[model samples]
Target: MKASNGTTQDVGGRRKNSKREDESGRLGEYGQDSSVNGTKQIGATSADSSGENIIRTSVTWDGRSDAGKILEEVLLLKQQFLDYVKSHQGRLEARLDESKKQEQKFLANAEGLELRLRKALTIQQTKDESDNTEEPE
Candidate 1:
């Protein structure tokens, strides 16, 4: 539903009430709040005394409304995130390789032990048979 006052949609597709700040950082259309820095933050939601939906949109400005600068910042953040993911993937791959190497080594050692055990059992059996062949003396 649309309100009497024009409302704008936010990045999330949710309708912003009717509270918006101008580039100068004034609340709605009636307020004077000057900040030391060039940054201004506005974000809130409430119902005005008139029972109208009010949504304060948050926007940052350094002096001029430069969409290019904002886009650049977003791109830079994305690149940083991608770089972090790549590094993490590389580390995980290294760990997987090490684990595979360890598994192979363990298998080899186990096979060697098994062979030695079988050889020892065979020797014991042969020795017993030879003793039995000898007559009581």
Candidate 2:
């Protein structure tokens, strides 16, 4: 079987009898032997030939496996999401500040208009009073 890391392993659960030339002319016992039963095959034959099959059903990961890479990608995405949120928060704060400044300016303008209207009303009232107190020719 080929792992994600491009390493080849014998997953056929066979025992190698002797070193033979494979179809690719490789002088290694890495080929699967049909004579050996998958259920009965153990680890590389020991010197004692105990006829015991040491089947490793699990793979040991050293942080370079596919799952590790996926975890790293997830963490990177999380950081990116946090950064996006922070950036949006800064923009929102700036917009809020700008809105507050505009509101203050508007309020100041309204107050100035109100003062001008009050002064005009007072001048009109004084002019009417002086006209009423004058003698008619």
User: What's each prediction's TM-score?
Assistant: 0.52, 0.50
Give RMSD (Å) of candidate 2 vs. truth: 21.8
Per-residue lDDT tens digits for candidate 2, residues 50-112, read 554534423555555799777899999999999999999999999999999999999999999
Which one wins on TM-score?
Answer: 1
Query: Taking the tens digit of each residue's C-alpha lDDT, what string does model 1 give over 1-137?
Result: 43445874444455668664475564354455444578653434243144444343325354677889889999999999999999999999999999999999999999999999999999999999998988586
Q: Estimate every model's Cα lDDT from 0 to 1.
A: 0.76, 0.79
The TM-score obtained by model 2 is 0.50
Worst 10 residues of 2 by lDDT: 52-61
lDDT of 1 at 75: 100
lDDT of 1 at 25: 60
